[model samples]
Target: MSAPTEPSRTSDAPGRGPDPRAERSRAAALAAARDLLIEQGWSAVTHVAVAARSGVGRTTLYRHWPDASGLVRDVIAERISTAHTPPTGVLRDDLIRELDGLRRLLHDPVSDRGLRAVIERAGVDPVFARLKEALYREGSRVFRTVLDAAKARGELAADLDPDLAVDQLAGPLMYRRLLAGRAVTAEYVERVVDDFLAAHAPT
Candidate 1:
């Protein structure tokens, strides 16, 4: 193996940073890291390797990511945060749309595999775990916005806990993606939406 390369600060290319060049560099590094994770698994990713793969220098990779774990965490956050925002009139419709979006994300050949690896690593890595928590908090915030709209429209049970409902809505998808490694199809998304609606429809 080659000696670990020096650290350099590169612009984020994929909108991960503010500057255009930084954004571009950041995007390039993320894409390279994502590919490595999917192709070689998390264990195979390193700052030097990512730099080499991204056509960036080790210094640049290090400047952006303190370590391999940090790089992976940022990559996951960047990818998940940019997912499509779903909208539907009814609770069921909204949920189905959200779940379907998640399913499509999880089924993506490159991103899915890379995300799975990152999640697995997050289980044992404290820094990654914290990053994961922050990402989920942001995700929940997005979901809560929709739930609040549904509540205003009287589409959800008046007494239902929005947080719990969000959990219920996402729990199955997480289970399938993380543990079962099962396919998240349109049918599956619809089924989950229907089940939640039946159990929590406005009374």
Candidate 2:
């Protein structure tokens, strides 16, 4: 991908405090960028394209997101953040809920492609690679929370590694849906949860 040419910063007036209009413009541009990624693919989310689609000034768009990947990173982050699983105080149920949320997100048309766009580029680009790492940290937060709660309640084996458990639960669903080209059914989710409980349940 070509580097985005730096755009000149433009402002309406010198501001000393928070600017709500700027926030709104940024939100609009991000929405437009996300739509472009889903509808047209990664190449269509450039600063110029986002500005045109969002009706925001190109300078403003570039000022916030210097390139397409920056826009993509924000979009992916926001999308991932929306899938919250309020822990039901049951370890198995919490893990299942989180994985199911992931399955639905992977199945969603918008996330299906928008996430892939950045993921596809992460291997070669350091910037995008960092973005992928950050996204992983975000996606794993729920697992970490649920696992911590379970371990505290003595519901899990004392020696179980929380991080590994997180991967164990989320990995298969993602692999089956994104890589193995298989259907991620509710039954599959339950089986995954059951297996996780079997392996990690307190002795």
Candidate 3:
């Protein structure tokens, strides 16, 4: 008779966790993908290119991502979702804190390039369009969280739309910093916060 079969090995099995080497490879591949995305545009990040740059085997990448979209999606998510500020219970202050974070991020040349690539590619590339949809869904989570808290505390109208608020708060910053190539100064941030508060004053 055949020998008793052993249970299939799984990462979730007791004492069986992610391999350090695999994790390192994944991090390296993501770094490579981010660099390629920013430096060479969205079309440059293929499995072969990423494997060549990251020194990770193509088979490994394919096993994990299955296609370039998976890899590119993750890189874009990381690019946009880098920071999250905890709420201070004051709506004005919270908005300022979040906008300031955006100001600083947009000011960085590397981040600026990445954001431009994402916007540009997402406009033209169908693959990036899908990724962009998924990204924008959750990218403003921190800002939404802050608004929800304000509504709960009677600091904002219950009927206010958080999605519109996100656009209102971030649209100016992007138009100025990215499109107009202007500096995002403290005064500009203040003006933005003031306008938003005026528009949506607490009941």
Each candidate's TM vs. the true structure?
Answer: 0.75, 0.77, 0.72
Superposed model 2: Cα runs more than 4 Å off: 1-24
Give residue 78's error in model 2 in angstroms: 2.6
> Which residue pairs clash within candidate 3?
none
Each prediction's number of clashing residue pairs: 16, 0, 0
Question: Would you list the rank order by TM-score, best first?
Answer: 2, 1, 3
lDDT of each: 0.71, 0.77, 0.76
Residues 1-203 of candidate 3: C-alpha lDDT, one tens digit per residue: 11111211221346876666776777899899888877876678899999999999998888777768667766665556546667778888888888888888788755666667667878777766765575566557778999898888877788889989999998999999877988999779989988988888776
lDDT at position 190, candidate 2? 95
lDDT per residue (tens digit) for residues 32-96 in model 2: 98899889877788998888889999877767776667787677666655467588898778888
In the range 1-203, model 1's lDDT, one tens digit per residue, is 11122222333245554565665777788788888877887766798888888887887777767778777766565566535465656666767776676677777765576556657767888966776666567657656777788878887777889878878888898788878978777888888878888887788
What CA root-mean-square deviation does each model show from the true structure?
Answer: 6.2, 4.9, 7.6
TM-score preference between candidates 2 and 3, better one: 2
**Index of the highest-TM-score prediction:** 2
Candidate 1 global lDDT = 0.71
